[model samples]
Target: MISVVIPTLGTREKELIRLFQSLSSQTLQDFEAIVVSQDNHDKVKELLAPYSFPIQHIKLDQKGLSLSRNVGIKYIKGNIVTFSDDDCWYKSDAFEKVQSYFDQHSTGIACFQIYDPEKAVYYKEYLKDPREKVGFLELFRKSSIEIFINLSVVDKEKVTFDEDFGLGAKYPSGEENIFLYTMHQEGYKASYVPEVVVYHAKPSLDTRLNNKAFASKGPMFKRIFNTPIGIALLTLLFLKKLNHLEKPIPFYLNSLGEMFRYKKSRKR
Candidate 1:
């Protein structure tokens, strides 16, 4: 059986409803869902109450995505454990494709492509490829599949999301990257199935900008490169060049705004 783990926070309830609905309609029905909501258990329960799946909603008082995921994994009892973000909706046959790929391959990690719902034109221009196998490092960069593992394989290999990096924490990203990196280091194989796709609604421009700015200088970058100052400088220079390429004035203005916000946050 497959156990789908979702680590969520204050997500859009409507989007989550759609996600659960999509999962319920999956071609493969031998799966359970485990939702770890950080201090939002009541809301998650209220929203998922209508669903007929074996969903176990766990509450985590802390506000870290990594911690929430750890909590969710503790209760998982499936041979294949799948992960999905609350805001992401899987296609009808996504899990089926994943199961098929896993059955054929002896890999520890499997990933899939992600489509942006708002970018219809871009989606048409790109992302029209079938599923294929890929290396772990390539999966680390482009694959959107959250880590799905076989519980039996856990003892043989060690992998966990790094709490220092992820959303709503000091690091704005790189949790998945670090997890996959660790898995690869432990000699675990990974595959990329393009057909097992999920759709993620992009955040607003403002939220994207904020996340980007924070991610550029976040701890994840520092850990990966060991050059925080260099990364910060490069990000600043890139923002300057990007501004010149499109909207120079607004880009610099936003950069300055982000810098000020960063400084103010640091002072606190």
Candidate 2:
């Protein structure tokens, strides 16, 4: 059996409907849908009441995406786990392909490709071959919003989405990357299957830029395996931005000094 987990914030009703509609058309039927909402459960209930699947709703008072995901995972009972976003819709064979891959390979994780439906026609031209397996780092390099993970065979004891990273938290990214990197470090194999596709809604340019800038800083100070090259890159990036700031030298110096302090603390 497969458990499809979706973590949402009680908004995006249109997107949610699209997601559920896609699920209803899935080629695979031996799966359960678990929706984790960070708001009133009644809203989700009313939205999904018409659906004819074994759908379960989990309400979380906490506002963090990671917290919502953890709550969803707790309610999942399938041998294979799949995650999707409320704003994304999957292909009919998405779960079928995922389950097929798991059946063929005794591995820890598996993932698929995500494209913006509005830009699907250009996906072939614009999409770069993700040379590496689908994991947290690779996902970070490509996007911040969409992540697909197969957590069934993975060591559940070691798998968790970092609450400190992702949306509604201090840093606006890196939770998925951190989780995948940690899983790899713990000796889990990850596979990427291209046939399992999902269409994610694109955010506005400003939102994308803000998230990119915010996400770039996360690896510098928050990551566990911070390297010298990573630190140097972050320093150079920060210094370049600092040079552009319309502020007094004292202000820039204070900020730089604080960054150095943070680096030192993280090293310890």
Candidate 3:
């Protein structure tokens, strides 16, 4: 069976309705939805009851998206698991395609594309060709919503999302980057399928080199690489994306400053 763990603040009643409604239409019925609500348990409970699939409403007092996902992992009874955002929904055939791909492929983790149905475009530009396997550079571009995992291949290790790197955390991003990198280091195989399996709204920002983006990315890149190398890469990235900045030097310096705020994770 497939398990979908969605982390939410329980405020998206309207969007939840739309998400569950799409789940109800899914051609594959062998999946469970685990909604980890960080607030308004009663409201979320009320909202999810009308859905056709079995729903596990997990309440969490904590606020971090990564923390909620780590908690959600413990409650999963399905062999195949996927992380989901409360506002995103799957296509009717999405689960069936994923199950088929997994049944045929030996990949431990798989990443797919997200489409913005209303906008008539992909959630972000995707690689045109599917990759049989991918690594760190590929993971950096992926959002949490596009990932699905085969639990059996990875259950032996103590793998969980880093709470210090996601929404409600110090850096506000790169949780997936760190998690996927760890999985790769653990010797698990990952694949990139060039198909759109889920639908989400267009992001308000897409890697624009703004002050907040610069600040968040500093620690993210630092955690992903050696300090000196990370600093070099960060500087290179700043200069590379300089066309997006009005004051390139100050924004570049902000990122340089924040990189020091995070000491790189010790080797496993």
Best by lDDT: 3
Q: What digit string (tens of lDDT, one per residue) describes model 1 on residues 50-167?
A: 9898888888889977767767877877888866777888878877877786788776666666667666421212334534445643643542244467555554225456676666
Runs in model 3 with CA error above 4 Å?
204-209, 264-268
- Cα lDDT of model 2 by residue, 1-268, tens digit: 7788888886888888999998899899888999998876677888898889888888778887766776677888787776677887888887787778777777666655666768544222233443245544453343322334455567555656777666776555556766666677877766555552677755643454343433435353436555555556455645655544444344334434433443322211
Report model 1's TM-score to 2 decimal places: 0.75
Most TM-score-accurate candidate: 3
Tens-digit lDDT string for candidate 3 (1-268)? 8999989998988898888998899899999988999999999999987776888889998898888988898888888898888889899999999999899988889999999989898987788988888856777788888988987787634568878777787767778888888888888888999988999988654354567667777787777777788888888887787777767888778878888876654422
In model 3, pairs of residues that clash are: none
Give the per-residue Cα lDDT of candidate 1 at 30: 83
lDDT of 2: 0.64
Overall lDDT per candidate, in order of appearance: 0.64, 0.64, 0.83
TM-score of each: 0.75, 0.78, 0.92
CA lDDT for candidate 3? 0.83
Where does the lowest 10-residue lDDT sum fall in candidate 3?
203-212
Residue 177 error, candidate 2, Å: 1.0
